[model samples]
Target chain A: MSEQLTGADILIRALEHEDVEIIFGVPGGAILRAYDSLYDSSIRHVLARHEQGGGHMAAGYAHATGRVGVTFATSGPGATNLITPLADAYMDSIPVVAITGQVGSRSIGLDAFQEAHTWGISMPATKHNYLVTQVDEIASTIREAFHIASTGRPGPVLVDITKDALIGKAPWRGPGQLDLPGYKPSVKGHPRQVTSAIEMILGSQRPVLYAGGGIIRAGASEELLAFATQQNLPVVTTLMARGAIPDSNPLTLGMSGMHGTYTASTAMQRSDLLVTIGARFDDRVTGDPALFAPEAKVIHVDVDPAEIGKIRNADIPIVGDAKAVLGQLIEAGERALEGAPAPERSEWFSTIAAWQRDFPLAYDQQPDRPILQQYVIDELSKRTDADTIVIAGVGQHQMWASQFWGFEKPNTWINSGGLGTMGFAVPAAIGAQAGMPDTTVIAIDGDGCFQMTFQELITAAVEKIPVKIAVMNNANLGMVRQWQKIFYDNRYSATELSSSIPNIVMLAEALGCAGLRAESPEEVVPTIEKALAINDRPVVMEFVCDPDAMVFPMIKAGGSNDEILMGPEDL
Target chain B: MQHVISVTVENKPGVLARVSSMFARRDFNIHSLTVGPTEDPKRSRMTVVVDGPEMEQIVKQLYKLIHTLKVVEHVPGEAVEREIMLVRVNAEAQRRGEILDAATIFEAKAVDVGAQTITFEVVGEPSRLADFLEIMKTYGIVSLVKSGRIVLAKDTKSATKKQRKSA
Candidate 1:
């Protein structure tokens, strides 16, 4: 007979079997047993100040490391708080597994204390969820949660366990068999479709390679670079795919979107064929779907069939893993190119180069102007190591960081891309730092964003994670203020954060972090040097930036990308 | 035009909720839905009748669910559809013979007979059931319940995976 273990023990064992290195969560009344079991386990737990911070941290770890990130919370408000992060992960397609403790079995429908339908409440947000009614089901629930999280087009999954089941005894059977019959994700591209796509690529005069975060998730960066370089196709990476193709490459056209580069925006509008790989044409990327790429014939490739024709119709839809499909395309291209002239898209390249030269990403770093946020990002990019992972909170600073920082590698850029959640940088930096211990992790945040989740730094300080934070104190909600200045007639309704803000440096010191501030350009490098020297604890460096700077190359909401503004002068 | 989507799923708690919630979020127009155990105790079948465009998306989304095993959409003329209903109608002494005569013509049996009412159980095509219910309404309907709709391919060639094994 197999030995018996409590449901909590089974859960901890299953997580360990899945090689979970760390879990971010808070302990509460309902999850006491699970916490007790975790105390003696091999897995490490980082106690979070709030469930929401922990949820984002898990997402950050998943986004950075390409592994399933895990978090735990008690029922009711604790689980409800995770909904936002789960929704963010769903929209961005990150792999996160969230586990929550529910009330006792008998108290399920009796309005028990701290009880909420965790599974039901998180249904719309999570990729899948489990409501455990039996102690024996804990093993399979944990296994399936991890599987569902990391497979196909990855997203978050939730597992809600009852307190009674956690304390109840069940036989210690190792990993339970997964019974998911409906989840069969296609890997290889269909042969006929691949041939058709090759024909389109070979026949087209102006072809562009569009890549999204799926390349990083599939680890197809090498394949992407090889294909682009071989075919001499100009490549455009989205915000989520900054590192898929290095921006330094002569063939790369940087990003394409609302605040994307002028060269990339123009190239996408003029391309005759767009070979879209792993990217869903999000509204932000393609401002107006119908008028997005008027002359382009789309050959869309994605693992999810539903996303193939969800928005814009695809002339050739290939549903398969990005890496597998790219690998297939490379081999097919070699055979098809035999004895044929090597294709060279020189004319298209020259057009893109002229745009880049005319409108390079420029910022006024004049000594007369106040410390500019873009200048700080440029300085940080020059000083940081090649492997440094940059996490950004949503706002004007996010655009500035993406715009200024020369991101040339995959898995090095992390942000709340789809949901655009503010306050993601602080905890997410800590989580990424914890996941990649040898690499430097920095959080580039705005004043309004920093104040939202800087408290999570205490967890890093006490844990000695040594993540750095750079707060751009522009004295206002920069992004919203810019919008109000442009769209809302400068009313500035509730967008100002400068009226009565706390001293961020003092707040950082109070949280046991090395705090420094730079108000002038000369002071910037010295403060950054001082912050980088601190290895024992986290450092928070505040840069008092100009409030007038707004993100450029703008496309107004519901406007077509064909009419992209170049800069403030264009506005 | 309405479309019939037949899905086979594992018999488990919350499976129905997962399937129904998916439909609600996708905004699929569900005219009627029915679920019951299959020959195998571990599996169940659901017949959902939905309308509107995006018929391809309806099937694609259902296949995304973890518990779903198979999904088949039944075309209009290639499949047979039926509905079962139990309708109770008011029967007065003067109207008893007339109601009985109407039920006889429609091949419906009196499952229950109270002093003032008679419950008729009938199984037929949806249109046939509507025709029978039209005549019974003259005697006045007290209450009625229906088993939405169940569908099957006209020939045995269109059998499910499990059905093929049993055959």
Candidate 2:
């Protein structure tokens, strides 16, 4: 029953065993053998214009489906190009497996043609990496790569196989056993720590649940909701944890951080107890670590033990999976409530409500001028379904989308949060569309970010992904421009992208997709309606937005959240 | 304070780079790092001495690495720490006797001797080796090679003795 197979065949078979439906990559000389085998395999391949796009597509697919995303590349520049996506996935804790072909084993260190130290270059960016010189180890290596990538605090894993190994013959064993001796992850919280956290939750008069990306990664949104609802605590989701609790939920205080809602940030700042679940206290969220949650006794629960006190110290640290820990907390909370009544915090809610009313998310609208970028996002959010998958690139547009989009379900909102990578939207949206064919995927990208990786739109058009891309054409790097204006005494430097810009609609049409443009406020709804109606192929909608529209409630870098400026007037 | 952390990791390629790079990325200065194979062929042990304000976070971060199996922070007084150094001193005929005397007093071994140089091997705590090297420098040292510190926790009972008694 043993069939002799090439190393490439073994790799394809291992991917099939892992139930990988598609792979995104660009083949090179080193990876020809693997591509040859892929031609006869059932797994579909999406040819990307660049290796970074392929890597991001895989990440997008993984985020959308909660499955390990797969990509392939060759050595040298090909492998190097995948670094950004690997780092992006690492920062955001997305599960991605990138396979690269190395030079022949003998010439690995001889400075041969197209030879780069893929293993060394990828070490810091990947969760783990493997360099296989033996053909027999292909299946096991691929299996281990996927396993390591998709496990606790999932991140990218890279497998670099020598070209000789890919072409060599080996006995087909059908997925060998993974012999990892030192990789054990704890998934359950200790009973004592869970009990202690529950006691703190019960004793506090004002408690806020700060949720992060770990909620979506652990599939613990339902548990988070149940715990929040039962305890009657306010929930503030971080940028990565936007959909952990529905924005429409009465207890939801919206996103909390630098660009977070005033009410949410105030609640975190004023709370007596801060119960953080699956969220790291990133610099963006904690503007100044000294001033972040200064009045609160923290209870940090994350799957990764390292995140507990990496920034702000936690009073109670529980190292376990978010879902399992949340379930335990819920059980403890219910039992505690049965024994004693829930603590009353009416004054805290009233205070938060006052802040919400006093300092709301606002944008000045000019009826006679061009559209505001935030207004376009708000309109899109109002028009789209609750289940729509909203993907965004970095910068002002990304923050605007996060502020405007009403996320009702987990996994419906995807963005490069930790890395803040630009040009992540279009390819990621394509990957999401490919993963969930029936669902609508929208990429809200800035003009600057869009131009970075916009070549991938050709893949979507050719693959018929039907993803909708809304380009907020502000004709400038809005975020950097805002920074220059505020901090540099209005010195606008290289942030301008208006000079010699290509027509976005014409470019989309040239790439074989339907193109539409909205120049005024009146044209916005019709352009969006037309784009949404076209489901056969991808559509690009360009909205010429005001270049001066800046994201507000700004907490300057290294400044405390307490010193947030409401708008340009505050400057 | 400087802390010595012994990390056990899978003997896989790029693992050493992963560990060292993490220290560099986190801005933690590594005073010394010694890595070698363990009794288990598939595993390697790394003794890393890092000077930093927060060693607990470094230990926890090491545990998060997939290739890292176990990390143990050795208490300063409870662990037996040693470093090995090979020094080739410019031992002229006149200074040869003086060099030998210094080596003997420090309990060092003369591994090689030449017409103009004598290479001595010394094993002791890092501070002791530094002192020995400083004395050798007065003799005009030719070359020096030092193995970064390696440590073993002092166990209350020896497993070998217990196994022997049972047998």
Candidate 3:
């Protein structure tokens, strides 16, 4: 044990022991001591204009690097602002550790200045939270927070440190053993369950491999590709699992859900078996749980046992890490198939192919029409390569980016999926860029989403992180407008925003960023190329897209997958 | 369906709140919950009875909490359970003797006596407690309180098998 150090010093030491390289945060009164200690530490700190931005930037770093990201904020309003990103991380199962400073220990329940009941408020939003008033507990609490955040079913964990603790002294015991008896994450699937899952896979004919964000989190994309190829299985990745398997692969189907491709949606509905790997059957993906895949028997493989039967009943449940489970599944499947006849799935492939050919993710891009969002996405995709990491803010532009970008690598596509948090792209892109300095990071955002968190451009410029921002400027909340047009009979309530205010170009200039605009099809490629060319600081490009554009091949919110709408005409 | 789930958790601050909040957020209707010190001083055991279609989900939810050390479900035919009920009955000059006679049949003890009311404490299986309450109703039940249940799995050995089984 080393000489006693201040709680703030121990906190920084603990983070250093965890091999943390970067921290995204905005300093305030409550966390001033922590900031002072961090200033002398080796970990780089990226100052965000808002706590929410800091939180999301950490999430983006995790999404890009497959590591537990860290963020810091002060108490009261500062901690409250982090709620959205915490909730987002919770919903998406991203690994993030957020540290917040609380009021002094004595003033805890008295609602002292800059104090909030963040411990209670963050309980449901975080995987776990700690309120440490004692100085000796700082290291242990931070250690446990990182452990909880990065372990099974990874999610955000919060550690609220009282101001007294930050200034108090504690002996430095470097990286003590975790007293977490209840937090064991199952890594290897049970042998019997693995065998049962293999049996289900062997017995099925029209099997579709449904992958999700857990695949990325578990680093199971390679296993997913191998198993799908070996079994001749068709794969349908969800929005979060876009690049789990290469979109160019013949057996791989595109994203499935509300704005899913027609082929992927149809295949899921008709498959005899859904080999769900690391994906929860969210209501958005299921449409209606009662009617989803009526003929399919599900084999759910997840790290979290609670997720097994939460939404859809699994015929075979394998609770373990996805990577380890997939490896187990591969060996078991090969042994079972040594003498048995291979499953005949030619007809199923043909059926899926026919749907793919007929629908083919088509869009109405007439030369006469103003710049189409779909066309811009395709242009950007063409300009960028597999190494380029794409972050999307939630909306029509998000769908267009996912649908059009031919992702061939894992961790290449990141977005706010489960929580659907808008304005995630701006700070997240900066965070991703910070993590992968050599790789290009682009935020394909909607006009509405861009406006929500665009202030982060200053952070990007100040940090000299060269992330490209492509705003599909439609001047309206495209998804909500589409919903209003279809379901609400076009009331269009408070969805439209003025296009002229703080013009995108001038705003980028003010924030010390290069800005360009593309209005027609001819200007699309040149404008994206121009944005990509600038590498010293952030660049923002406005793609003037048609306001009337809508995401197609959508399944109605609560409607059955069988009743999917191909376009506006079907609606 | 109702399930009797026993969860072993670390004796930490806000642990009960973490568990209770999980149940509320997950939309589980808890019937009765009892928590106290366990054999190990560092741990506490919580006996929760909840009504739901998905008992497995309830069990999984309990196990998901970071403080939850262990979770055991006491299946209906395999476990013995008990609850304590305290009932205050209106005892007039005419009904005082009758109320005492009814309490005697339930093996209840007169814990307190007031001007016109007699409070009896009874401990038994939850159903038996309910039956005793029903009998006390004839004397006009003034007030009643029921403690959360505590349960233990039956021993495999035949030595302690009781002559009467609880419903």
Candidate 4:
């Protein structure tokens, strides 16, 4: 019954099932059968410079389109080459479906030419993977991969089909109704749990709401805003949860984490009710589990029950989808507050506002010193508000951008949060720019991280979706060195990294985009202004920052939040 | 406590990396894992026993961790997970049959009836291998090779999913 269908037919059918408009990859000999199937399909096949680039392109497309980005590669190096991007997607909670053609099953372990153990190489990076020995599983396998990649936390899934599976014919009976008893996604929030959470919220005098990326994934942004506004709750965001609440909203607090604002951190510390909606409370967000929100009774509402109390203890865990949970909460809150006066935690709100006023993201001017990355990021934030989408790579610069950049909209701030992936900002910005070409897209990258995916600059040029990349070149892996300085007692170790930082101007010119370099604090503003002026092509501005500078409010490993060492002197 | 867990995942590309990376990201130290063909040709069994205190979290994370794989916990006291070890012991020709008799008692196979030496394949849990190693050392064990732990669930159904559904 499963015969008469080759692997190619199954792949084509699966793409159709996924409604995949495009498949990005660089084809090789091993995957010719899959390529053959794609020849007549309506889905556009974009050939990239390299297989790795194909993976990035798919990731970018997914980020912009809010759809599952699809990529394919031939066997051997083609399959192995995609490991980096797969790892990137796996870390950032991006939805991507990577399909690779494999050598025949019989040739799997024989080490045939172009025969590589892709399953082994990719196992660490994907949510799950499949090597379909029989042709019948193709439709079902692809369906499951798409479902898994986009559901729950949303991550990448890889499917490797053998050449024989692709060539041998089997009767295509479409994905058989997908009746996996174990695979049902949690769509509705647990009702009794929701009631208990509402009771806690209504009882608290000083309550604060914490929302995460799950809100955006669940398409519950409006619901979040409405609920917070109705309940008079101040909201804070995780790095991924940036756009879930508008920064301009009166109740919105800035992002929280290793680089979180003092106000958000303080609010978290002092709040009586910590209502976490769709957020995982990662270690990066909650510095130490033992001391995080110590006084607050947490009510966690998330689609994935596994996330509840994973890092911090949860008082009330309502396991269900966020959108549905929010709806239930809104209804219950309305019923509970009928003809009753609302409680205004004005003192708490005033305290948070006071902190925001005192700090206000300030930076000191050094007349003759090197340009500071924080000043540059602050100026960019000043120039563009929430409408602008900002992406950043991990490092001292990423921390600075997260702290300094005042993002207003959800999906406006993109970063590799949990994985702390370097070289993520530039390509991700390119992806964001592609999705909303009308909106200004800015990528803040560090010197060491930018070079990782700088090759994608050519793709930006070709696609004509220009994204401005601001490179904070400190000539070192700043974050690692900061850790070494604090934890290793000033021993630099192997953290001192010096590589030729190409004249970003010349590189930008080479890539057919605008280029600027800021050597001092004064030049930072003009350079960013110049880059923003170039609307047609992408721009790369290299800002040389103080090498010895460190990310302030650093919570050392196994250290409490109170142990944060802010500057060089503290370190 | 550290645990060695074996996962039976559909034989596919990058599955091993996915599992190992999860352990690394979560800072879960994996003792050992072995992947090979199972009774079902299409599905490969990964005998990975991970040791950790938050076994509940580890078990919960596994469901969110994969799409097609089933994680069955086979801890020492509750479930059955076994290991196989082959040890070459230095035994005189007269004592070979006695060693073979011991091997038979343990359901072990005489892989190599070597002259002046004998190699036996013993299959059991980690403790069993330790006992066998200790007994073989009495016979002046010359060399030994132990297969990394490969685990399986005692019941046929995936237990984690059952727990989740009940929860």
Candidate 5:
């Protein structure tokens, strides 16, 4: 009545049950059995350079495909390495599954070789975790892991299977009736809460819709658009929620954050009512928690109950999946708007349009002056259509890209937002390119952030993914140096870089990629054009810029939203 | 509204912090808490009393926390609960049997017997258990150990599959 199966067999079968198409992972000694079983399964395995890279790769793939991305690692360092990525995914609320191989059940706790307390370490990062000692429990554990990872307010789940469980022969029952007594993911919205939110929106004169990533993940974008159009309400998206409404849609205001479009940010600030869907109010998006949406009565809707009023007060909090909740709201809106005239907000719309015209994000780079990072990103964005995916590394370059490089959609701009993980860009771009092979992948990296994982150039070349990389070579940790200059009275202190890296052009050539350098504004557009023309292999363009540049309009940590610091304003 | 509930759980990673954070983020007021390993090394239990304005909100949060597998059961102490409190009282050697008789009357078992001290293990619902310990206070209580409040449904088997089936 039982089939002879290793723990790996059960794991793969569990993943198959969850309809996972691909998994990203790196093999290690303790985890070889899982790889062996994976060799036979239909699921595609992407071999990444490091376990952390594997984690980001999985996250990028998940973000792109809207399915939970799965990854595996060996015990000890392998498990520890995946921790940062797990934390990043958790903060961003992306669904992922990280399966780590553990030391054999017998060798655990003896200070065994390559043994780390993975379950304990990843406890805070994962939505849930399982340490399987018994081989018979593997299938159920994995089944539960997927259920937890993809359920209410999806997040990363870790399953640490011991080596014995992976190698040992067991009768796999094929994930039979998983009954975890305490785990329940709510799939439906509270009827009363949803009705109240819809009522408030209907009653308001100046109402705005703030959509987040949850809309896309819930597959509710169409519902959102229908509701917005029917009600004739303007919609704004968080950076993560970008493609929920197409940027070209007249009702859509690009993105709302620190560098969010003036129209969207102003509208959010002035609206009588704001309906937040599937978006956590990240600090970057909400400049100061207390002052954010001060004039607006907030209606926060999300799948996770804990997120409601965690930072900001919610006048009406609807707990449910965004799509389900939106569906209900749309139905209510349809019923209410029958033969009714649309509410007028002509004056408010005119005021917001005026702000957009006056404060449009524009920097005129002198054609004769040395190239700036902003100029490079602007040129790249101008040449490329909105279809390109732009992944950024942490530093001044990342800030510049966020401020200047226009993103028409979410998942198109991938970066570690809350965790501020550096060395994220290249691997993330690699993963994004892998996920969407037809789309152009661009990694906007600083000189400092590029060196963190530049070795991944080999990954791009090997995978034959023609990703375009624009390196803003400022020769310093520019963002830190900017803080030092402004806050620490110009004490540079460990921020400067005197050493030279392999001239990026030569490095790109060595890695079998087309290398180009742009040191002037005129060269910026031409370089991007030249690089995009030759798409057979990957290309890396190095743009040299002033090392002392800073991202403008920055509200320092612990500073008020009104106290924004534009560059050189102190001077 | 305030409710004091104890939960029996499997000692595992992130369980305590997760439960605590859930309460903190939900703005639930936690009045008192005590957590320790149980008689079974494989399991740990926690007793938490939360005071908040809304009873339903607190219960919903508790339900969510209880859904984590580490949490075996969370039940209100006033409803159906037990605390096995061990009290070591200083008793004259001659009066040991009398104390034993008292322990028998209280339905307590003698866990430790000594020359001048008699220790009794009392397991009952919280109120009865507290009465037994209060009586022991008259005997010059030397020390006491309590298993906090390990709770169960008044009708355990019935509630497990009945009310919680959808959960």
Candidate 6:
């Protein structure tokens, strides 16, 4: 049945058909018509303090739930504000659909009020975008936008509609056909490639499974665990793939990269075969491309064909969905090893075990002294459940959380890995908490990162989202300060944050949330317990940590993984 | 090395701007670019000549664009190419006869003849047009315009036959 409807109504109907439960945005002049239509619908709207916050919130929702996140904004400033999160989603391969309201078509180039060339600005950042000038095209455009955003190698997509288009009337039919002929993505792995990969896996003496975010994105953590266990291979998860495999597993090496574990990097450097699944060999992961995994022959499996051999040459490149490829690999392995015992690798296991024991992740702590940042994270990890979602901001605190948190399942660790955007924790935590209302959500943020987007705590309090926030108050830009101390002749230039900083506890109280402070080691446990006890509103717990703490086991930029700086002794 | 790339994109507003902006952002210099409607009404063809060492990367990146339907690199021997040039030169009656003689030699057509100048149109290889323009420059050239190179791949049968003969 066809009925007369405005473009705004058509857009809302399309979103409803797609089962979009919530939208994070702030309404403005150009989008007022859509907001009016939104009021008459059943979907919940989350008002963010800033457009960037809304965009990050949408990203968090998508990252946690594996669903297409939706956000709306006005044309000029609103669209510009969305650039950071768009770039963030693009770099991290998150699926997000952003809708913006542009000035009427007639006044697009006349320098009208709040007019911007949104489609042009978003071209490089978005996977795809559309500009709708007709009312009848709204439904199909929305359908296509969702399809493109959530498909293979998902990323952000934008759709900008002119105000005249929104106000215009048309007969509302259901979402029409998506007629995009040039946008097909491959989903099944080639049989010959799968056979070759299995042969390599079975023949190697020293093999390491380098799992990446694609495993989590493909929701194939079970298959990965089965395959790794079946092959008796050691697994190293990258920063974005932290929770893809349980850290408690005997074969797991925490993270491999700039601040990765000594065992993981050494394993990568010494292994004969490095099978990479769903993870790009980023500069942070592969410190020096020529020297990284020098003895390893790579087998890369990813859904995007362009990612294969982009940085490192793949001996066996499989372009297919991670889940499908992993399934095929498992079946092929079972057939190849039929009625045969698994190869014994006691020698390889002992070597890796020695590395793990000799250079375990450790930090010094003294009783009755200033609190250590690592201690705070350790305690939080101890107190939280295995299914708790831990989100962090960028910089030193991000590294600490990634190291200290014991992730046991996928979708439990979320952070800004690719773009390294600070101020991502509070709003992202709120979004994650909203998406998974029954699960506990925690944001571990640094004092520097917290100062960037802490205003979103107001939204959390008003919306009654109970998320626990832990601020590791180091009172300085810890990472940059450490770098200056080491490489810049110990000249502390512009890294300190102790000058005229606001009191965080009072700030949180002012924002209508319960705030607690822990200055000593004794207060850490009680404060965290109290914060965890709150169920009606959000709670912020501030831990005054030592400013001199540094992330160790560091591979300096442009340095090989073999030249790892373990600590001050090495320096 | 200089490489010519042809791109097919959906016929929509601002696509040309998008393509140019991509080149500008990547800092890839475009030696010449010509865009026009193709036989398919919904799509347009663009011919771009670029000077770079990363032509493979450029082709891959261009294909990543959502609106871009197809991209192909035009090899010199496997493709037929042409360029059109229109030149208006100073011709004051006595020089008109000499200019007409040069035009005839170059297989050019006299399109317009004003009181003091004459316009001639020529179509040929880019090198030939450049040589003709050089000769016309000596006759006191007034204005000139050169359409960038346009290309079409030869039929598949002939291309394969040539490859077999080379092999």
- Each candidate's B-chain TM-score, in sequence, is 0.87, 0.86, 0.90, 0.71, 0.63, 0.87
Candidate 6 lDDT tens digits, B78-110: 877789999999999988898899899899999
Q: How well is candidate 5 docked (DockQ)?
A: 0.25
DockQ of 3: 0.38
Alpha-carbon deviation at A55 in model 5, angstroms: 1.0
Q: Per-residue lDDT for A107 in model 4?
A: 88
- Model 4 residue runs over 4 Å out of place are A1-6, A36-42, A134-136, A170-179, A339-341, A365-369, A484-501, A520-522, A566-571, B1-54, B65-162
The runs of at least 3 residues in candidate 3 whose Cα sits more than 4 Å from the true structure, single-residue gaps closed, are: A339-344, B157-167
Higher-DockQ candidate of 4 and 5 = 5
Local distance difference test scores for all models: 0.88, 0.90, 0.89, 0.78, 0.77, 0.87
**What would you estimate as the lDDT of candidate 2?**
0.90
Give per-residue CA lDDT, model 4, range B1-167, as digits (tens).
Answer: 76655566666555566666777877877777788888887677777667677665665665565533566665456556677888889879788777777777778787887678888888887887887777777789888887787665557543343335311
lDDT of 4 at B52: 72
Q: Best TM-score goes to which candidate?
A: 3
Q: Compute the lDDT of residue A523 as modeled in candidate 1.
A: 90
Model 1 segments beyond 4 Å from truth?
Answer: A339-341, B86-122, B130-144, B156-167
lDDT of 4: 0.78
Instruction: Tell me the lDDT of model 5 at A115.
Output: 96
Q: Which has the greatest DockQ?
A: 3
lDDT per residue (tens digit) for residues B1-167 in model 3: 88788788999999999999999999999999999998899999899999887677777877788888877777676778899988898998788888888889989999999999999999999988989888887778899998999987778722222211100
Error of 6 at A59 (Å): 0.6
Clashes of each: 1, 0, 0, 36, 2, 0
Worst 10 residues of 4 chain A by lDDT: A176-185
Which of candidates 2 and 6 is the stronger one according to TM-score? 2
Ten contiguous residues with the weakest lDDT in model 2 chain A: A336-345
Tell me the TM-score that candidate 3 gets on chain A alone.
0.99
lDDT of candidate 1 over A139-253, digit per residue (tens) = 9988888888888888999999999989999998889888776677788998889888888898888899989888988889999998887667899998888888887888888
Q: Indicate the docking level reached by candidate 1.
A: acceptable
Candidate 4 lDDT tens digits, A289-352: 7877778889988776677768877888787878888999888878878957567877877888
